[model samples]
Target: MILEEKKKKDEKNEKLQTDLCECYLLLNMWISSELLSICVPCLLKAASKKEESEDTRKEVEMALLALCNLRFIKIEQELYLNEIKEIIQHHQEYHNLTRLAYQSAWRFLVSRLWDDNSLEKVIVVEQHFAREAARELEELSKSVDWKKNKKGGERKEKEEMITTLRWMQTLSFFFGNCYLWNEEYVELFSSIVGVLRASRDNYREISEKCIYPFEEASGRRVVKIGSLWQSGAVDVALEEIHKSAKDDEIAAKILKFFMNVSRRLKEKKKDEIEEMKRKELKRKIFEKMEEEGYEDVVTSFHKTFDFLSNKYFFDDALSLDIFDYLVNV
Candidate 1:
């Protein structure tokens, strides 16, 4: 009797796996379809409503998350150059979807964006996504068991962790992409620092192996920027500052650092001396940002920046205020 019951349970588990696989296939097809925005809510409902094993439930959730990410990326690609205000207006209606999508899409977009140097879109995409991934990982760490488990337990946990790490590596790729474009990808640079600081030993090791090239590329750019600034290239400095400011806190700190360094350079009359001081300062600032994980604050700034830059400032500002309060606490 016991043997028969075990056999029946095994069959049920196999069926659950089959169902989850079907859902994932459907999701992948839906992502590339015009019906993605429409199909997503239905999938989310199904994922929530379905009676399945833990593995099956997680698979469904992952599918839903991936679809959500694809939809947001589509929207981002369409509105990449539009005013922040316009993006926010459309984003408000889709905020729930955006949050869900960020879990999967942010990492994927960062990975893809980093690899393609031909695309001249904003570099902040990588920073935003990486920061979000780090945040999610941090939350996951707070809940999950990191130690080895018995039998099927360890495999299941490892699968989930691997999925999460894949997303992190994706974010790292975009960080590299930012450096590829102008080397002034300070937001990307800062985000990479943040992720490295927040990540566990295994995640850190993997990210370094996969994503360190972009960091190297950005380092080269920083050198060029320093040289230009020494040659009285205030305009170049300002441009770099603007691009970096896309990260809000990083921007503010970089601007302040630049102002101080430029002042010292003028007084010292030695470009090499000024460069040394500035490099040290840059290192310290990046370390501080990484240790504090201030990249997470950029999301709130994005909403506000979008609001202030738009015509519907009042409405958007109020909505963002509510969002900030909820997210920060």
Candidate 2:
């Protein structure tokens, strides 16, 4: 009946997907500029194919591997770059493919970003990646295997977590370089704070991986009542500051977060309700920093890094004046 016919059709599709993967791998051994240019469009089509079955997933991975092996200059046009960005931005693809395949595709896309210094491209890619990374972060926090993997449980789950951390570093790079809109910051901030509070042993990893974006968001007017200060983002960050005080980088990032939060306190010309909200947020953050002994932490870094000097050798000192005018605000 119809069930038997559908099964036969699935079998045939699986076989064709497997054969195409084999052919793509074989062709990768003899990659050339002209051959790659001709093959890349088709490869992109395959790599972005919606994940319907295990066979289709493998075919997409193979196509990505083939694309990775090929020369970038041969197919670095807007069409191909957009195709690759679309692949990276597709949140469902993260769940469908193995960690290896997903990592390879992302690395390939980043390689292109580093080579091109176009601000427009960087901004566009950052927005897309930020949304996807936020979704992945929320998903990771809820995953059962992620909880087990934290306790040295499963190899595959551990690798997946590592991949997620690396992606966070990539996000930090984006936030450090470009400015994201308010909506993007709200979503990313909510997810990052949730993950940090939920984390157990990997606290430093979470702080180190996410500090830049947190810093970026704190510098902006991200004072949405429920998502920002009210959600305990500043509290979790201060708690981490005490927990990670021994690590200078994480501590410095936490101080920068406070500095940025304070900088927003100087904003003017807001409506009555908005001004009241900002005042309350500033009061809570300053109070928490005092309770957590942040002055000792900031003074410690200043003494070590010589933040008092007018002329310092490292530009990192310039960024971490710790007590400087919090921002342009």
Candidate 3:
């Protein structure tokens, strides 16, 4: 009876999660379509729902508020510029949703002005909100135990970090495409780099046991890491029950240490030599994998490397698998 009850409870939780995810997806789609009035009501309902946690509710509220700002822009452009001025003159709601809302409003206003028009008003608005958002993100990033929380929390920290990185990369790509780099965007990029550095540290900690590094006969460094726990040294030793396992375990430990060093070195570099060395390291890794007959592993590694390389340099939409890869691997 207890087991049956537990199973039922698990099913109920799954159902609730699925429902919430569907609602969020619809909300995002509606926002993209400029149907903010429709999206806001649904999001507000979700935000007020008693079944969800505070975090989930807050997330929904933020989405609704963002949509409200977009709606204001759309309506102002289409119908009510004069009315919007009067509303802003009288109502705090027109002013205080979030920094993102304020920025969006400023952008909408600036985009309306002719080149001959002075940008003093719009520039003031933009500077105020951009600074506010930057301060908030910076404080939040600093205060959070990002590494530990990312490793142990119910929410997958690695995936969230990767998603955030990809979003920043996309923003940078768009800015470059439009020849519109600005100080505010540069600060955003710096914040992303900080987040990525934190995530890299977390990945190292969580996957410490699985990595191995060694110098091959060619004097090049080779890293042999397990993709999953069972495929590593522990399982091999289990199979070879008669052999002395101490030597193999020691070798694995040494290799793991070297692997960690290689990763850290690559992460810390800013010069051409370091870039060349990173490529050389990747080449050596594939060569070693091929020698070990791990062709599938080599293929997967190439695919991941290529995917990230494209994501870094191109203005393309990222795959959902990028999130899974970053968080899990």
Candidate 4:
């Protein structure tokens, strides 16, 4: 009886695997039909991890590889994009993308979506992916050995660090494409700030490799303006200031982030919730700056860059009530 049951189970497993392979083969052949729309969601779900088994991971790898080669028209993609978003956002595990296939699948999907010009359609998708990326960033930050310099790090450690940096670059690209206005986006940028705060030894690398690209891609307008404040980015900035006072470039970049936040806030039509959030953010910033003696850091940054080109930059930032409160107090 035991042998008969085992045989039945093995047959069932074999049939399921064969079915999955055939589905992948059909998808690879570019069969753009209603049938594919059904298959695509199934593939996404199959790729999503639910257990720790090696067999499960192998299934995920195979599904993602098939997804990497997915070819759908704009209309077909539009129809099932929400399904894709749901599967990717809620079903997939953030820490399980250790395989090259997982990375390639995401890269492929994002790049394909990059061609999409329907801002109305893609913004929500981008926001969901951004949150996922933020989760990934948080995981990477925790995994890193922040105390070690790059020269002293092991090869594996360095590879992980590089992966984290590349992830930041990816976020920069996403921010460029999507409007960064949601409160959830605050979580995303906050994660970026968190990573920057933790990786103290890689300050220059983060700035040059990550921050500069992010700044260029996002500009000042895409950000929701002061959303960072609601996400407690002020605290992260203060923490960095306390630890790395001598790194004026990074200090300047931090100030620029706040400045951009304040500057953009001034441009927005004030809703009551936003106004309330702004006041709260301003109060917290002032309290933390005072408690941490960050006034000196700002003073030092101002003195160093008290250049003619930055006169208007400081003026614009201070024009906001938040920066004005900081200055007067």
Top candidate by TM-score = 2
Residue pairs in collision within model 2 = none
In model 3, which runs have C-alpha deviations exceeding 4 angstroms?
Answer: 1-133, 149-178, 203-329
Of the two candidates 1 and 4, the one with more favorable TM-score, higher being better, is 4
TM-score between model 4 and native = 0.54
Candidate 4 regions exceeding 4 Å error are 1-115, 147-157, 201-222, 241-249, 265-274, 290-295, 303-329
* Candidate 1 stretches greater than 4 Å from native: 1-101, 111-127, 147-154, 158-160, 180-273, 278-329
Clashes of each: 0, 0, 1, 0
Q: Model 2's lDDT to the true fold?
A: 0.57
All candidates: TM-score: 0.36, 0.63, 0.32, 0.54
Give per-residue lDDT, candidate 4, residue 65: 58
What number of backbone clashes does candidate 1 have, counting pairs of residues 3 or more apart or in separate chains? 0
Candidate 3 lDDT, 289-323, residue by residue in tens: 34554433223443344444343332223233322
Give the Cα error of residue 119 in candidate 2, in Å. Answer: 8.7
State the lDDT of candidate 2 residue by residue for 174-277, as single tens digits: 55444334455557677877776665454346545666557555654533433556656776776776666443566656665666666557665359997777
Weakest ten-residue segment in model 2 by summed lDDT:
307-316
Every candidate's CA RMSD: 19.1, 9.0, 17.9, 10.2
